[model samples]
Target: MYMPWPLPDENWFADTSRQPEPDHEDLRLEALVAQRLSIDWTTRRQQITVAVQNRVVILAGVVSNANARQVAADLAYDVPGVFDICNTLRLSGPRRSHR
Candidate 1:
């Protein structure tokens, strides 16, 4: 067969892996998640942190209650391109109160 251009070697595609690279997509995801959490009334006042890597969303920081924690996770999950959710939210203060 006649070729106008030289064909590349196999090594040309060797570096193409499925590993996630730090790019604008990750930044966009992070911003979207943060925006969702900030706008939602449940997580509006909570100190929740959102991080995205390889389309996976990581929710961290402390919340006032379990509902807030779940809300954060849910909001992150709702974002597009979110492959998975890592919820590491902790409840602030003691679990139970005594008089």
Candidate 2:
């Protein structure tokens, strides 16, 4: 039966069907996440792992010192549209002693 306002047709059971697609918000979020992951910090390359979700970026990895950690956080902040950041970076390497 055709399902139309003040109109009905026997072809209501037509084989043609509309497929649902991802919402614009979902697409936007996905694009932003991709951009976040693709970013590479020049100061610390091997000591970082970044994950982005819903505009929130999560960083989990190892660093050499407090300076390195600062670098990581700053990198996350540099990415546009990043509203939240969860830093879970562990410090590594020996601390430089000041004489």
Candidate 3:
């Protein structure tokens, strides 16, 4: 068998395990959520604050009823990559539970 006289050696210890992390995805998601909640549904628009940290969403605002609370939670849950959501959204009206 014949081989090259001056062939270079192949790489055997190259580092290929480190991956770059995303920087602003969480901040963008939080801002989008807040904007969606602040939109006016009926005659006048209400203000709702949304804060997201490490895929956990926290909602704080004056909701109309339990339905509103549920909707808020659902909205946050629908977002992709959500781990645990903290629903602190308070309702403005009275409380009524089906169960």
Candidate 4:
């Protein structure tokens, strides 16, 4: 009589002993936020720095004006996994009046 092969145990493919890396999610969120900011026209993407921790995004760097700063925050918020935005962008100077 021919016999069929036995199947492996449920844990055969999985290494349950290892814990998930915590920084992976943070890094992914950071990249997403950064990409969003980079493509936007309102904010100075090159001057901005993006950081993520526990799903919270921190925007740090120099922006042209208050509107740019707010735009950065809004862009970050558009990311799917972003929990909060810490906008620390500083304005270069007051806007000059155009004649």
Q: Please give the ranking of all candidate structures by TM-score, highest first, separated by commas.
A: 1, 4, 3, 2
Mind giving the per-residue lDDT tens digits that candidate 1 earns over 1-99? 985664665455566666666779989999999999999999999988888888889888999999898878888988888899999999999668686
Give the top-scoring candidate (lDDT).
1
lDDT of each: 0.87, 0.63, 0.66, 0.84
Score every model by TM-score.
0.72, 0.51, 0.57, 0.69
Top candidate when judged by TM-score against the true structure: 1
Local error of candidate 2 at 48, Å? 0.6
Q: Per-residue lDDT tens digits of candidate 2, residues 1-99?
A: 986564465565667677566556545654554354446444435457666555676778786677767766776676666687788878887778999
What local lDDT does model 4 show for residue 18? 93
Per-residue error (Å), model 3, residue 29:
1.5
Deviating ranges (above 4 Å) for candidate 2? 1-42, 94-99
Off by over 4 Å in 3: 1-23, 38-44, 94-99
Q: Model 1 clash pairs?
A: none
Off by over 4 Å in 4: 1-22, 44-46, 94-99
* Candidate 4 lDDT, 41-83, residue by residue in tens: 8864448999887898988889877888898999899888788
As for candidate 4, its clashing pairs are none
